[model samples]
Target: MNRENVLVIGGAAGIGKQIVLDFAGRGKKVAVADINKKALDQLINESGRPNDIFSFEVDVSNWESVQNMMTKVKETLNSIDIFVYSAGITKQVSFLNIDWASWKKTIAVNLHGLFFSTKAVLPLMKNKNGGSIIIIGSGSAITGSGGGIHYAASKGGAFGFMRSLVGELGKEGININVIAPRVIESDMLDRLYPSEGSKNTLKKEIPIGRLGKPSDISNLTNFLSNEESAYIHGQIIIADGGRTFRPKSG
Candidate 1:
C-alpha cells in the first residue's frame, strides 16, 4: 500500500481544490488547509473519499495560524511527502490606486505566507529526506500583467525565493519548483475579466485560443510530484496555453 501524504495550502477552492480532489481520487492521504471553514467543511462532505481527505483551517498571512495548522497536520498526516503552496490573493487595480493596506496584504499572502508555510513544513519534509515543494506562482510575476503591481511584485519575490531555496533544499533530497500559470479559469480570472467580451478577447490573445482550466495546473502538479519529475527542480513552468511564453504543442 502506498501511503504518500500530501498537504495543499489554500485547498478549499479553485486550483487548490482541484489538486486536493485529484490526489484524493488516487487514494493518497490528502489534507487541505484554508482560511474558509465553510468551504472546507463543504468540500469534505462532498468529497466521496472522506477517509482519504482531511481539512484544516489556516490564515496564511498569520504566522501563528499557520504554525497551529501545520502542527495539527503533522499529527494527523504523520508525514508530508508533497507540499503545495497555492494560497494567493489578487486584485486588478491600477498602480496609482494601490494603497499600503492592499500592497501589504498581497505581499503577506503571496510571499510572507509562503515564507511561514514553507518554514513550518520544511522540517517535516526534511525528516523524510525526500519531498517536493510546489509553489502555485503566477505569470504576472513575469509579464507584469494581471492582478496589479502588488500581485506581480509579490509573485516575483516568491519565484526568486524558491529558486534560491532549491539550492539548499535540493541537496537534502527535496525539490522546490514554481508553476507560474496564467489566464486560468479562477476566481481571480473572473474578477480580472468579468465580462464575456473581456474573457473572449483574452482567449483570442492566447495562441491556444482559450482560457486555461484548473485541471491544466492540477495535472502538472500531479506530474511534478511524481518520481519521473525528480530531476526537475528550481524551474518555473509556465502553463498559459501560449498566452505568454508559448510552449511547443503536441
Candidate 2:
C-alpha cells in the first residue's frame, strides 16, 4: 500500500501537531510546515518518527514563504495527497477593544493564510488523483461565540473563501472541506478557558460531559483525508460534542 503524502501547515503544535503525529503513525509520509521553529524541532525530535515526518519553516501569511514551502514540498514529497491548513491565532477582546494590528494579524494568519496555501497547493493537487484539502476552522464562525470579533470575522471569511473554491475545485477532483472543532484539549482551548474551574464549567455545558481530545479531531481528519469521506465536501462539519447553543442570545 502506498502511503499518502501529507502537508500540514501550522502543524508544529496543538491540534495541527496531533494531525501530523496521527498521519505519521499511520505510516503516511507527513511534512509539517510551521512558523515556530522551536516547536517544529520539538515535534520532530520528540515524535519518535523523525524520518517519517519532515519539517519546513513557513509563515503562512506570506505568499513568498508559502510558495517557497510548496517548492520544498514538491521537491521532497514529490506530490501532495492531503493538504491540511490548520494555521490560526486568537485574541479575546471586545469589539470596542479590537485594535487594527490584532484584527489584521488575525485575518492575515487565519483567513489570508487559506488563500496562500490553497492557491499554492492547487496546482499540485490538480495534477494528482484529486486530493483532499481540509481546513481546520472554528465553530465561532457559526455561533459568533468564544473567540472575539476579529477571530469570528476571520473564520467567517474562511467560510466564504472555502465556499467559493468548492465550485471551482470540486469538479477538478479536489475535495475541499472545513472541520470546525471546539473545546478540544488544545492550546486554543487553554487560551479560551485558562482556569480549571472555568474549564470544568465549560465542560458541563457540553453534551459529552468533558473536553474533547485532540484524537477526536485527528480521527475525523483522518477520515476526511481518506477515501471514506469522498462524498463529504464543501461542508463545515462542527465537532464540538454538541456544545454550541444559544437561546436567541438574550
Candidate 3:
C-alpha cells in the first residue's frame, strides 16, 4: 500500500500522540505540530523510524503561526493527504464563576485554534485534489456537563463548523468529519474529574462501566482519515462506548 503524508496538530501527548504514532507505524510520513517542544522531541525520539515523523512547534490558536507551520509542513512533506485538528484546551469552572480572561483563553485554544488550523491546511489539502480532515470533539457538545460549559460551547461551535464546512467544501472533494468522545483517560480527564467520587459518578452514568481510551478514538480517527470513509462526510460520530445513551434520573 502507498503511504500517505499526514499532519496532526497537538500530536505530542494524549490522544493526539497516539494518532501520530499509529500513522507513523503504518508507514505514513507524519508531520506533528504542537506547542510543547519537549513532548514533540520525545515523540520523534521514540518513533523508531525517525525519518517518518517530522516535528513542528506551533501555536494553533494563532493564525500567523498556524499559517507558517502549515507552509513548513507542506514544504517538508511535499503534500498532506490527511489533516487532523487535535489541539485543544479546557477550564473546568462553574459557568457563572468563570472570569472573562479564563473564558477567552479557553475559547482561544479550543474553538479559535480549530478554526485557524483548519483554515491554514484547507488550501494545501485542496491543492492535492482531495484529502481527509478529522477533528477531535467532546461529548460536552451535546450534553449539559457541569464546570465545563465553556468547553461545551467551544465543542458545539466545532459541530457547526464541521457541518458548514461539509456544505461548502464537500463539493470540492474534501472529506470533513468530527469525532466526539466521552471522558477519555487523558490529561483532560485528570483535570476535569480530579476526585475519585467524581470519576465514580461518571463511570456509573456510562453504560459501558469504563472510561474511554486513546485508542478508542485513534482507531476511529484512522478510519475516518482513509478512503474507506469517503462516503462518510459532515458527520459528528460519537465514540463514547454507549455512555451517552443513558437517561437522566429525576
Candidate 4:
C-alpha cells in the first residue's frame, strides 16, 4: 500500500493528537497543524518518528495561515491523502450572557476554521484524484446544550457543510464526513467537568458504562480514511457511547 500523507489540523492535543499518533502508527506520513507550538513540539517529540511526523504552527481560523500551512504540507509531503479538521473552541456561557466577541470567536474557530482548512485542501486533493476529509464535530449540535449556543450552532453548521460538500467532492473522488462525539475524555471535557466524581456520574449514564476515549474516535477516523469506507460519504457518525439513545429520565 502507498503510504498516505495525512494532515491533521488542531492535532496537538486531545482527540486530534491521538489521530495523528494513530496515523503515524499505521506507517502514514502525518503532518499536524495547530496554533500551540509547544503542544506540537511535545507531540512530535513523543511520537519518536521524526521523519514520518511533522508539525506546523497554524491558526485554522485564519485563511492566510491555513493556506500557508497547506502549501507547506504540499511541498513537504508531495500530496495530501487525508485531511482532518479538528480545530474548534467552546465555552460554558449561558445564552443570556453570550457576547458578540465570544460568539464570533467560537464560530471563527469551529465553523470558519473548518471552511478555511477544507477550502485550502480541496484543490490539492482534487489534483490527486482521491482523498478523505474528516471533520470532528460534537453531539451538542444534535441535542442542543444550554451553555454553548455558539458552539452548538457552529457544529450544526459543520454537519450541513459536510452534507453539502459531499456531492461536489464525490464527483472528484474525494470523501467527506463528520464524526460527532459526546462526553469524550478530552481537555475540553476536563474543562466542562473538572471533578472526577462529576465525570463518573456522567459516565454512569452512558450505556457503554464509560466516557468515550480519544482512541475510540481515532479508530473510526482511521477506518474512514481507508478504502474500506469508500462507500460512506456525507455521513455523520456519532460516537457518543449510546448516550444519545438513552431515555431522558434515565
| Per-candidate local distance difference test | 0.91, 0.89, 0.87, 0.90
Q: Candidate 2: misplaced stretches above 4 Å?
A: 1-3, 245-250
**Per-prediction TM-score, please?**
0.96, 0.96, 0.94, 0.96
Decreasing lDDT order of the candidates: 1, 4, 2, 3
- Give the best candidate by lDDT: 1
lDDT at 115, model 1: 97
For candidate 1, the C-alpha RMSD (Å) to the true structure equals 2.6
After TM-score superposition, the amount by which residue 89's alpha carbon in candidate 4 deviates from its true location, in angstroms, is 1.0
Q: Judged by lDDT relative to the true structure, which candidate is superior, 2 or 4?
A: 4
Model 2 lDDT, full chain set:
0.89
Candidate 4 colliding pairs: none
Where does candidate 3 have its weakest 10-residue lDDT segment? 144-153
- TM value for model 2: 0.96
Superposition error at 219 for model 2 (Å): 0.5
Error of 2 at 83 (Å): 0.5
- Relative to the true structure, candidate 1 reaches a TM of 0.96
Model 1 steric clash pairs: none
Off by over 4 Å in 1: 1-3, 246-250
Each candidate: RMSD? 2.6, 2.0, 1.8, 1.4
Better of 3 and 4 by TM-score: 4
